[model samples]
Target: MKLKFFGAAREVGRSCILVEGKSTRILLDAGVKVGEEEAEVPTIPNSMLQSIDAVIITHAHLDHCGYLPHLYSNGFNGPVYALKPTLEIANVMVNDYLKLSNPRDVNKDWQKKMQRKEKTVEYHQEFRVKDLALKLVPAGHILGSSMVEVRLGNERILYTGDINLKTTRLLEPAYTEYLKADTLITESTYGGDKDTWPPEKDVLSGLMKSIKTTLDNEGKVIVPSFAVGRAQEVLFILDDYMRSGTIPKVPIFVDGMIGKVNRIYRHNVIFCKDELQKRILMSEDDPFKSSNFVMIEGKADRSKVLKHQGAAIIVTTSGMLKGGPVIKYLERMGSDSLNKLLLVGYQAVGTPGRELQDGAKEITLDGKKIKMGIKVETFHLSAHADRPQLLRLAGRIQGLKNIFIVHGEERKMMELAAALGKHYKVTVPVLDAEYTT
Candidate 1:
């Protein structure tokens, strides 16, 4: 088998990988990197597009599935396999990406065609596409996220796509028992030796404390979050804390695409953790429909929300503060030192959020430099596995001989490779690099 890296080889976005067996060629993911200036797609050649027999999507995150519509537009009409919820969520993510970034490349006709090619597969359900036997296991990163296992000829390959080994409030841990693979392809998003995560309880406590301080001072709290997994997780934390009297009751405004994705999450509770499923199905206390959480309908409602008298929590999208309604809220409420901006996910370099995190007092937004005094705080509520968790996961796969690390910065990838080099033949492939195994 041969593996090729088109993107996300030593970076954190545009994750595309091609696997070529003796008789079949499969694309693992076709994604785009949402950058400061423009989006970046994979580096696949035009001649290779028609040779791909099928595409397997590991999750719905834009970094893992955003470029799929472009594939259809480029005349690749192979079957796309994923969990049902991943497809539903990817529909929302890809449409939003088109409106923001590559509007001219995709049309309604291409979208319909892509949807017609979708093939939903359940966890552990074995399926065959041409010469490859495949199965998906839960990846615990988000709802419907999975790791792909492929068997061809006499070799087995396991691809870990944005995995989280530790369980959180929403999902179970990644499945890693009785799995055998000769080559392991994994992500190294947090693979540095110093990238250990704090305990979950402590992280939650710190986040609540920050919010409580702002609320006590009668200031609204603006939480810039990703629309899919991080937004939903933050909402649940706030609701659960409010119900337990850990924090005072306050209006949690849901903006951007978060409210729509929340409904998709609620509808697919079967993919969530056992406790989350029980809370949704076994009672009237659905966290997704919390009374304290209100949806901002339109511009009129957003204006009304900004004019409210008391303290509130606004959870909006464009997590990196590159775009979306979060910017509007920041413009209006940012000067107030009492108000707070809580970042709940990874902020990419060159983003406005990263600037704030790096202690920048002035930022340029849409060709305008704005001065701000809002209190900015970051809580490490990440969904990716840390260094220890990654090592633990690698230690579990039976018959693993080679490891390929992708989806991280160069330094962190090297650190992880050094750690894993003692046990296995680890290779950190560069962009467009190909290797045979």
Candidate 2:
């Protein structure tokens, strides 16, 4: 078998890997970089583009499955496999991408092309297509995230597409069984030596304390979160704490794509953790259906929300404040000294979130310069495994000959390679690099 790294080799976006067996070719996780004007896609050979058998998606994150519709525009017409929930979420995301990326006249044709090529697969069930035997295990990153195992000619390859080994409020930790493999493809998103995460308990306590301070001042708290996993986790945390009287009960406004995503989460309870599934089945109380949550139905609702007298909590997207309703909320609340902005995830370079975290006094948004007056705070609520966790995962994969590290910055990947070089041969692949195993 031969493996090729087409994208996301030395960088953290556009993840595409090609696996070539004796008789079949599979493309793993065709995706695009976030926040870029033009997409960075994988380079496929002309001979193999029309004959590729399958495209396996590990999750619905844009960096993992965003570029799938672009394939249909080309000559390739084959099955695209993912978990059922992934397809559902991707249905919403891919359509939204089309609206944003294309003009009104040409968007419909692109949307129809993606719909005809999508396929669904069951988790943990072994299936075969041509010369490849495939199975998907829970990756524990998002609602339908998975880790894929491919078998060909007596050799097994395990690909971890953005895995998280630690538990979050919404899902269980990543599956950690010692799946033996000849080669392991892993993510190095948080593989640097200084990437140790703070304890979850402390992080939560600090977050509640910040909210309490804002509420005490009769000011609103703006939480700019990713509309998917981060939003759901924050909602569950707030609801759980308020119900237990551990924190003040306040109205939480769910905005952006999060409201629609909540419905998807409710519909797919089977994929969640056992505790969450039991809460849905064994109890009458639904955790996602909190009375305190108020949905922002349209842009007209924004004025009413901002004019409210009492304290409130507003959760909205784009997590990095690059776009979406979070900017509107920031424009309204950022100049108030009593209000607070709580950041709950990694802020990529050049985003407004990173600027605020770095103590920028002012930022330009929507052609207007806004001064920063709200209290800015950060917490480690990432979905990726840190250094020790990454090493532990590498240690657990019984026998491994080659380990290819991707999905990280250049220095971080090298740091991970240095840490894992003691026992196994670790290679940090560049874009379009190919290797035989």
Candidate 3:
């Protein structure tokens, strides 16, 4: 068997991997690179990509599945295997991704890149092509994320798209059956940090304290969250705080694509924690209908948020504080000492969000330099596991053979490789690197 990393080998954005064996060749994921630096769109070597057989998507996040359309446009005819929800969410997220990006770059290359799209499959479902048998399992990272196990010839290889071992407010714990594998390809988004998160209670308390301090001074709290997992979690945390009177109930403005995605969340409540799903099916415990989330509607109405009576909470998208409505909110509310910006997700290098978190006093936003005077506080609410949790996850799998770590920075990937090498044979591949076993 041979493994080739076309992308996401050195950094956390685009994730593309190739496996060839047992009369089958498959692309693990064709994700896109993101962040501030002007970057070239990623594609596989023309030599290997021209006649690809199939693609198995791990999740619907842009980074995991965003490059599908580009792949199809580049001349690859293959079925994309993913969970049902991954398929559904991918449709929404990818189309939105294309629509939201620059339309001005309509050259032949750009046109071809966006010309074709992806097909979706479901979980536990099996797909066979030639001699390959692929099974998708719940990954528990988002609504439709998955881990995949593929059997070809006599080899059993497992690819974790992106996994979360611990259950969150919205997702179940990752599937446990694939604890045995001959070859395992895993992600190392948090491989450098070992500290497990503090108790949820402590996190909640800290969030409340920050919000309270801002409210006392009558400042708005602007949170630029990823429209999917992070947004939902933040909203739930705030909802719990307000319902229990742990903090004052402020008008929380819901902007960006998160509002639409919330509907998708409610529609797919079955994928969430069973307890939460049961509550949704049973009583008046509708978390999405809280009075705090004043959905901002119409483009003209955005200015009215500043007209609100008291301190407000605004949740918008483009998580890394990169773009979207968060930019507008930051431009309007960022200079106030009364306001605060809480970063809750992984901000890649060179992103404005990362710059802010790194304590840049002023940043250029939407073509203008804004003095950042807001109280900025970072909380440990990442969807990815920390370094220790991931190491623990790696240790639990039995019969694990070759471990390939991807989806991290150069430093982080090396750190995880070193840590996991004490026991397992850890291989850290460089961009476009290939390994045979």
Candidate lDDT scores, in order, read: 0.90, 0.85, 0.79
* lDDT measured at residue 189 in model 3 versus the true structure, 0 to 100: 84
- Give the clash count for each candidate: 0, 0, 1
Model 3: CA > 4 A from native: 37-39, 103-120, 193-195
Question: Which candidate has the top score in lDDT?
Answer: 1
Model 3 deviation from the true structure expressed as Cα RMSD, one decimal place: 2.5
The order of the candidates by TM-score, greatest first, is 1, 2, 3
lDDT of 1 by residue, 46-144 (tens): 678888999999999999999898888887989999999999999999888887875567876777888999999999999998889999999999899
Point out the worst 10-residue segment of candidate 3 by lDDT: 102-111
Q: What is the Å distance of residue 368 in model 2 from its true position?
A: 3.1
Candidates sorted by lDDT, descending order?
1, 2, 3
* Poorly placed runs, candidate 1 (over 4 Å): none
Count clashing residue pairs in model 2: 0
Judge candidate 2 at residue 315 and give its lDDT: 94
